[model samples]
Target: MTDSTAFDWRSFLLKWSGEWADSLPESETRDADDEAARQARWLGFPPASEERIAAMEERLGRQLPPSYREFLKVSDGWRNAGGFVWLLAGTGDARWHNNESGLADMYAEHLDEDSGPEERREADLWRRGLQLDVESDVTYVLMDPEDVDDDGEWAVYTWSSWRAEPPERHANFLAFMRDMHREFHSLGARQGDTGPVFANDTTRELDARVEEARLAALGGGWEQAEKALDEAKGYSRPRAAGLGDQIRRLLGKTYMVYFEDLVTDPRYTPELLPPLVAEHARHTNWDDATLRFQLRGADDELMSLAFETLDQVRNGTYRYTPAGPFGEAVDRARELARWGGSDAAWRTLMDALPLWEPLGPDHLAPLAWVADPVLGQLLTPERGRELLSTPRAGRTGTPPSPAANLDPGGLAWLAEPDRGNNRTSYRFVLVEGVHPEELPGRLTDAGGDGGGGMNGDADVHGADTVLNAPMTLWDARHTSTADQREFSSYDDRALVAVGRAGTDWSFAFDDRPAPFHRPRFVSPAAAAGVGTRAMVVWSGLRPGHRKPFFHLSMAEDGAERYAFTYEGGEIRRSGEIPEALEPTRFFGDLAEGAAAEAERPLLEAVTREFGASLPRHALTSGRLHTFTTRSWTRPPGQGETYTVVRRDPPPAQWTTGGHP
Candidate 1:
């Protein structure tokens, strides 16, 4: 079966296995004794003989520990139904496995219309939760690109939707993403603030500032003066004397916005801007636009963190109480949900309030997601009416527009008037972050008083729908940014600029499941620092009495792969791989692993763009692959900007029709 969504594995595995296992009945429930007997069979005691165990191990190319091989016989039927199992070709660790619908496509290659008993028996290992070797659907992997930790802790491995952003499994992934984002934020945040942040009043401010700056320029022909502008670049600066000086004011404004101390400082030089010019920042407005544009962008960057925090409050995703960034945003979101906005938006806000608060016995924050099915519960039928009833935030505000002067009190205030009555509409963005997949056939299905922008058409169209149905995961992971507003002000069907698809996939601690893998996706440096060193190795496949057991480890670079195998239970470094083991097959076994390692560095803005289904006309999605590491946590003294994508390509450009 081909499972279109790769992200569904966790839910699918737990759900399908729990149900399937529950269906099986025990013969007598004496598992302890039965386990021993089963091991005896597998180990070839009477049912299993030492000679049989030795012969079986020989065929597999390795000897099994008496304890491990014994336990396999009594294995608990099956509880897992996805990842790393006996499939047609590759024996897991690297190849892809399609469950729902994709599984049908691959299996069709080896089997007839139906699977036989032997196929079913082989499949049982997966269902019963047997060993999970890595699978090749690796999104990305990598070793530390810089300093190699001799202790071997610097490396990261991660995977996600292919459609998602590129994978980034490297030695220093966690540290790397953070290092990159800080600079990304410091510089990019200004772009949104000055250019297009969805702040309180975009149009009015832009218009007002533009006019003021222009007038100042027209009057002062040769005099330099400082002024701010809201139009175009989004900020104002002191114009130098003369007409030429006035026009370049916004450029100066942007410079100051990016490096606050630079322009404002008593002694700053024009040389600071030279670097930008060399990087193709034409005319200087580049500094202004890039800086402010990214402030709003931060919203997008942090939205996932916010949803994750909210999810924890919603789903209890972790065992320990998480005091992470997700927690902070929930507190902020709850505050936003309670905020009563201009007349029209109030109802939507109030209706979404319940989804805002905490609930469920597990106290998991995500259970509120269950309420998403019945969005109708969020509305009060009088919310839109109520916005009009509440007094404005700070009086003295202008009425929405001469047309919407429906504000009989004349004390009306709308967030934006630029698109007033034009095809565009505005609403306080935060309410319920509706996932597109979760959207009902119609807006009313969620909680519509009838027109909160639902055009009543069978097919949904235009920018208007976003106000009524905002999505968290869809909105969060669907776009990329230097800051959070990119997510907050997101109006299009965006693609996320995740360092890697996400922080979900990880490296196992000791090849055992308990402390299986730390859920935290960290930097390669941290990974190597974590203590356990599970190497890549399998032995005894060749003749001349090669070692039969192998242990795993890596060199400083994590590039040249090596293993330590066993000869009579003693560990020895066997630098060379066995002759019998095919190099292609060996790499195939670790297809998942190597891919994960290779993808580490590329994850910055490559992964996390997966599974994004958007209309062609709305937006052109793309990746910011030129991420140059920059963050407060990283060592000072930069080689290249961590946030800046390709120096030449710039990575700011996008593609249409879902082209990569």
Candidate 2:
């Protein structure tokens, strides 16, 4: 690390110029009349003479801070210190902030009784501090003489109107400037722009250090590599930022690295992305970090490759063979995978990660098995908890468990009383051997509305009349809208949304109240006509109902195979129950407890028996094709009692085609 006392302002400003010039808009560069095109733009003004510096200090009746004084001796003032700061004031222009702008008084008037002591202190300092920035966008840079360190270095602050509460404070002027430099690089990177490279000693040295770090990582000197990359990033080197991210991913700080100019370079993509994509596939929820791979401007072919790899993983066809020093440990994992010990294989690979080293800067071995077709499925909620609960090399504490974030497959979400909208009631129909695309139309027909106006001609009445028309599957925008209304129940006119569960199974979600709430009302004919097995599951815990109820009805080929409804600690069973229900004690005498206690276990047993699962996201946040059903009309009597159980049923004022 370089000494702060002997900081090289000239070299730092030189690097700042390179970044500034590169970030200038193309239109500005094209116009000769633009200030950036007229002269040596972004370069600092000539150094202030000692006499001038002394005169300014004498006028202010205070000695200037050492770092700021040295900075003026090198460059009187700088243009474009960072993207947010347009210019720094020179000796001739610098003044006390209060003298020019009475911002302290303005802020004081707004302060209330709730304002804390820190806020008051900050407001007072705003009046006394020496302002450094002459031009900026709602941003101020000031040095406070009252808050000096032992070395006479004044505290520096960068404040912006958009920020909340306290401004960012740094130990000294040098620290503040360094942070600004880093911000410039981060801003550029986020905009998908890598600032122009300068072939100066400073940049050349940083680039060399990056290369050395790569070599160190390749040779298993991971700690050394991490240190070098960390140092390089302090200078805001774009390549170092990308490489540092990669090291963090490998060292377990994160599960993936994002796409960046350097990280996604053809030289690195082949090694870096395969394992990252694999890690992504293992996740139940695609959080922002994992979803960034599909952002605009990402490599198209790489994304295609990621999707194809995921398909292979799901189909149990993807394979990987580790090479070099990592080969032995990874091969052991592969053996475990082949022997059907998938969870063991994942644990084995995770255990060897600390010792495994990259074969080359562009070669990431061993980790590719994370995307291995069979092994990827091994990262269940249980394994995720285990991985997160254990501290890894170089990590300070146990990592946060992603277990809760992991998708609890099948009907697991039903047991969570506070899940999406917290309506305390859920009804869904699961069908096997039906394509997701075909379910909406089939469900429409089953609702007995002559295909629910899928041809766009059937009369429909609801908040979203367009539901009668076909829509694209996985409508992300609509899903996002639904997710935002977390506290509001679905309107009475709401219908069903369909999504795929497994390779050959589809499920429908209905959030409306009864008599539309029953899965039987939605019709089993849809599943039977297609000669596929289907199951309808319903559970309600709304207060004041005669009893909280759990219902399951299974149908195969136009016939009811088995059915049961458990309410108020009583269960009614009919037809031939599957053997899977026996282990769950579904038919045993009721225990003296709440019926809700047995709901989850029964749902799990049914899910296992039918080999069906619905992604929680599909119901909570994911968008799916929607359809309106003829649920408004009562079906002809089928020799079974139909009851409207909700205390707040649809208003009698609403017509239901003369059916009551």
Candidate 3:
């Protein structure tokens, strides 16, 4: 007997196909239990024992397929479909069919050895392969052992009894059953049936409807979501009960979106509270201890007290709704904010934006309702003054390029002075000491004799060796600062000067007045006081489009710092690095400087490029690897860049078929 782990058709029928049958209308389905009992009445009904199967195989001089063998273990022969579907032969029947050519009598008659040459030739081929079921109506249902794929998986064919030529083929028995099942359902549907004869229960459909409702609610279409849930309730009472829990969870998420929006918006008003509070209470038994639930039914005085209570958004002492410790509410908002460019990219932002407007110039009070302390302080009037007093960072000698025409609205809004004068400013600086022990002098040395490139090297040295040397910051092309028709420009000479100076270097500027700004000072002390030491290095502005190129600051550090806007641009530093970033140190053998924790993003980029998780041990273990690649836009070898790899060799840099 095959172990249960191997296969048991009995369980499979009851669990999979049986379950599907149970879901169908009574008129079109059979219960598996009843089928089993009926099958027991047939001769050899207890299912062939393993010894019987083995003895049959011995006589046939061939092994049965795994799926078929597994099926026989559970059922010697099935009495399914009143025996009309097909009569499966057991061990005893196997010999009579094979030796007596029982298949030939049923299907080989179609071959007709006396047929015309062409037809006869094709018929002979079918005769050689066809294995017919004794009980099937159409000889079409048969297995063609001669028609096997490279994997030795025989194809099953359905043929017309009148013609012995090619028959329609299915890849295997499983596929044949699936198509048959589908045909059965489709036939029933066409015959005025209410549902598919072989269809599974409404679980799949129910799950889909539930997901749709949740998404609708998240996107603020609450009415549509409610309607969806009501419709879902009709699928099945039992299933609907389970879905009720999911609906509540979704409702909870929806409430949080609105709750945080009301709490954060500086232009909040008492008028918005009634609808939100009322809806939350109606949807769930939330915050019963506080006035939250009461406020839902509150008259003027009660409503006023509710407002006063909720106004203190950060109060942690109260035992309210089952949904406790609402700090995760803000976390969820931030998660939504980070959904950049995905399908739901703008969902939360759009949902929350209308809840509260920004405080106008005349409005200066801190939004005490904001539970997040950092966010609350940023909205204060005094903070706005301090931001304005700060000097912007960026070099100003060059004229604004013609390409800088587009007003950087959203991007510029990020740098507003009143919101935080320094908020609009950006900074770019040189991270000291983070260099490979030995940089590759020549590109050829990294790649093997094939001379393509380093196949893969798991070491800091290997990575640096492959890295394309950066263009000098002071190069005339980069530093010209000329008003060219195209805004494609780089000022490498200044960077080279900073690199040579040996001190920490950076550029900072608030983009309040302009989308692009020049650095006002090169002093490190000034960089230190501006809240964050990071800087934005403009790659260039595209003419007509007026699109400014940039790289996010914290996202790049160490060797990645050498990367520029064209390669991977930098963005302004926002907030302080939780800890001082250690510059990349260049030591000969034990060269040691950790990639800043702030630069984990750069590490993540490496991981993504390699298509795997890059464990910290791989890098720290000194088994890191590297691959060198060049930009197609630049001259061959000119734009060479070495990237780090871990555990495995880096992917080759050649087009398929060996074309470079």
Candidate 4:
């Protein structure tokens, strides 16, 4: 979980010793130095008696692996003393299956090629040392496994560890495992098939090899093994050595089948599992666009397979959480639901996603992708034009799209209407939810779908109530304004007139009100119902200012002010401040010469601090002001307002609330 926790495969192997044959006892009678003898000793594959077989099946509540049935007859060559290996049969040629590799053909090529057994023994020892030399921390060296050919000649397994020509085998194996893991991973990725579904070609070949091995046992090549398997397991417990001999000879014929399956058809995908797939299945049909977003893959390589997996969930191949952000995997599925594949694949993927989390606004963007009006803000301006348009953009920037960004654009929306004395003033409100209520707003690359605070400020106004009509907000830092001392601007600010884009931004200037638009703006959520949270970053609180003050409170009956804080109850604001409002840029200190002496008139200090923020000073009531309003809303059509917190003396403060 920390820097100290980087993984070590060696440590993992050491810890997992139980999963290997390390616990098995060695046979002292055989030459420990002999490779053939040592392999025979360890590979005591024997058939279970009938009673034991039944008991094992009953215990596991499943059929025993068929590979164990063929190791019983006496003729099966199992011990090192025996000249033949029953598993390989005579000449080691796997019937119908290509065994033209390794020892199978080598032994046949020149049975007398090596004169003495000592030479063979030494060579085997050398190889064994390479696989388990604890002193050197050395594991098996990568080498090609030798096999037999149809013509009974020796050949090397193309990608066997002993031979390393094919580097692509690892990837192929990984793909196979990933897909197979979907099927039989006990955790329940697959339930109905009772087997594995490997994707990679290597695993497919591996599966074939295993079956070939099993078929060998049935073909009488390992007669002893078949006889051993036919005996009742419980009755033959004491004769294990004899039974094991038969089984060992048949192992090459049978066990290989099971081993190959383990590597090839591993259970990895949820389609092989259950219950979880059941939940995700809903996304496959795609009634809920939010769910579709969670099924798409990061890369396209797995899209087709992923889509197929989704179909399995829909078609009953497997079952799992159909949709959710519950666990890491499920959460990812939720994301893919919107971005999984090509149009058609997406439908399949969407339908396959199971529901793991509750449906709400925060999930809509990923669900709808650019279709989500709010998150569309994340696209680069060029991308935004491309994604938010109807026809999309052409290569030459010619009519990129016929549509506009329609989702939540991070502007703090009003949850309710304003109650005002003048009946003409405006108000602001906040969305009612667990998320914090906002005051300041900005346009940024992050959280455009209303997840976090808006990136910039609400200063792009097109004069009085017509807050910058085009409503285009760019997320930049390091900007200044007329009341530069009062508030810091974005690194850069972009302004555009309402309903007008393309080089027409007369209102793109200093101190413009951004939220006071005359024409009502609709949120993307309103359009799609499901959506994400939008965090607004719009506030210029002078440092050390105490809040909870009703002057800017929306609850008060100042009509417009009353209309604004409709849901202020839920809007999270800094509890209180001791000093006046200072933008975050100043931190806890005032600019040079601004603090001045306490004896200096507070108005002058205010002037130095706020510059030209207000027309009047000294907190005088003589400055009658009109309160403006803004709104905040979530998806599925709901809204309210908040009384704009501004100074009556012109360039006053508008503190949208959230902690710095």
Query: Which has the greatest lDDT?
Result: 2
What count of clashes does model 1 give?
Answer: 152
lDDT per residue as tens, model 1, 373-453: 112122231322232222222222222211131222110121122222321211100001222211221111223221222
Per-model TM-score versus the true fold: 0.15, 0.50, 0.26, 0.19
Clashing pairs in 2: none
Give the alpha carbon lDDT tens digit for every residue of 375-486 in model 3: 2111222222222122212211222112111112112222223222332323223222222212122111234221122222211233323321111122212322332232
Q: Rank the candidates by TM-score, best first.
A: 2, 3, 4, 1
The regions of model 2 sitting more than 4 angstroms off are 1-3, 6-100, 116-118, 128-141, 145-154, 158-171, 178-408, 417-423, 437-442, 446-494, 511-530, 542-546, 568-570, 579-593, 630-633, 636-660
| Better candidate number, 3 or 4, judged by lDDT | 3
Higher TM-score: candidate 1 or 2?
Answer: 2
Where does model 3 exceed 4 Å of error?
Answer: 1-8, 16-45, 80-84, 94-122, 130-132, 160-166, 188-199, 202-660
lDDT for residue 423 in candidate 2, whole number 0-100: 59
Candidate 1 lDDT trough over 10 residues, lowest sum: 508-517
Please give the lDDT score at residue 28 for candidate 3.
Answer: 49
Question: Could you tell me how far off, in angstroms, the CA of residue 632 lies in candidate 3 after the best superposition?
Answer: 51
lDDT preference between candidates 1 and 2, better one: 2
Ten-residue stretch with the least lDDT total in model 3: 492-501
